[model samples]
Target: MPAFDAAAEFDRQVRTLNALGYPALSGRTEEQFAELVAPLRAEAVAHAGTPDEADAPYDPAATGRVPFVLVVTRALAPIERTMPLTALHGGKLPGFVDRTFEPGSLERFVATEEAEPPGRDGVHLLFDVERGEEFCGVVPNDAMAAVAERGRSLLTIEEGVALMTHAPRILVKNKCFSLGGSRSGDRRVPAIWISRKAPKLGWCWAGNPHTWLGMASAGARRV
Candidate 1:
């Protein structure tokens, strides 16, 4: 298909946010954006706690080898894909796992593989880091397929959980973009009408928020 135009998308998001009562975000420099969202960031910090105090211990075996296994499960759909500012402007929106998606019982896992090919079946993408590299396993093939979708998927396998959790919290508290979408059956598909500029920071439903949010509040926070 056509390239995803990042510049146009960003401008459109800014306009949408303006209409929604948020300060304009389109033209602001990263620093300016930071300032505008400072309060929200602080709120996220309070909720998340300190980096050292809030995190789980490190594990060495998670990343020592390649092609790690993970007990994958469906967490959330349409998580922000990590694309560089240039790539976005050039029109290449990718995919990333929704940080919020952890089995209510198990919140940790790892991956040794780089991520499955885009159309491959299975939960091949990685998220939640520990030490330099780590991997884990999950069951249910659809979990993998849900995480890997039509866009460029940016799932990090080796890092720290802080990065995984903090990144989204920062964006949410900063009022980056809220999750707005629809619920089909048990699955929540994001609303496409809402414009999301920072596709890497948080999950913004793919379309109109009103239809989704108005019809069912269930999908409001799933992302």
Candidate 2:
């Protein structure tokens, strides 16, 4: 498994944004880019709180648009291909080979419901199985909902009496995209969030979602 390199990933993000003409972000050096995005990253860290206090009782209402830091490491071997599919309900999750299309954006990588097309910009990468865990970070229910609507899932099951299963993971590479802040009632909410910008600009379900009730994630302290 590969280690998550935040600095390298940050450089990649700056390059992508530069290539895409992201307003004033173009033509900046990697160091310069790092300097520019450092505050945002710091803000993410601050929003997530101390490592020990994050991802418990996932609560987005309170976080309100603060950004969080996340380390994007390689997936575990057994279920490496099985990405954790986020949904309002597990029933909403797509089965093996099932694909769904969602809006595309430059903020992060986008996946197509259909299998790899001839010239589509998006890629069909799998999600990390360890997503939504405390070690990764907290992902609020609303964030999960936001991901489910746009993200696609794929699962493989063996044809047998007991039905053995194969990997099931979400894509985390290729196209670019971003998560819109969660909403409460009529007002839009912005909470701290994190994404892997290198291998791809995407979010993982590694954070423990159950802990988001009144906190960011399971085990996270309520601020």
Candidate 3:
């Protein structure tokens, strides 16, 4: 079985983002993104032999994906800001906001009261990310509470987008996830899933439950 390649993943992420013109969309230059990840790249190289424990908790032998995700935070790349620029399946299909998500600016979807992302500008490496697959069919409200009790914070809209941005395959036909990190001062919870075989930025009612959607979470975020 193939193991997760942290270094290669990091490099791939960088090149993919640069190819997508990520830096410019986030008020950064390609050179700056490279500079930001230089140390991270080095660290990845040094630790290439062993991927982070969190990256593979959910059947590493089967998935071969990593625990953490490389993110350009809402501070640098708001959910709405990154929506048009985001894509699915390794940048093959561009993402878009659902017409029903008339919430104007996706930034309005703020982190929930119990959640705390590394609220700073620039890049973040989010570790131990759970796609909330277990939370499928769980209502958004209950799922958020369960996440808190487990000492994990739900993924914010920005983080959700970032996760899919880096690992597009994670957002599949029936295994989509909710951004428990955000709420629009209403019963709506922001989520990402496939729409007509394409990744979509959309919302769901907090009170409802879906057999296919799970609440996503992360153990930690940092520079």
Residues forming the 10-long window of minimal summed lDDT in candidate 3: 56-65
Residue 138's lDDT in candidate 3: 89
Worst 10 residues of 1 by lDDT: 214-223
Model 3 earns a TM-score of 0.84
Residue-level lDDT tens digits of model 2 in 1-223: 2333334433444354344333232244656544544544433334434444343332322222111222111111111121221111123432221122123211122212321211221111121221222212234445445444545221111000001111111112211112222122222121112122111112323233323211121111111
Quantify all predictions' global Cα lDDT against the true fold: 0.24, 0.25, 0.73
Off by over 4 Å in 2: 25-35, 38-181, 184-223
Q: What is the lDDT of residue 64 in candidate 3?
A: 26
Residue-pair clashes, model 2: 54
Report the lDDT tens digits of candidate 1 across residue range 1-223: 2222323323343343344222322344545543443333223233322344234322212222111111111221112211121112223443234444444311222221332222222222222322111101222123223333422122322111112221221221112221211122233332111124433422222232321121101100000
What is the C-alpha local distance difference test score of candidate 2?
A: 0.25
TM-score of each: 0.23, 0.24, 0.84
Clashing pairs in 3: 55-66, 55-67
Highest TM-score scorer: 3
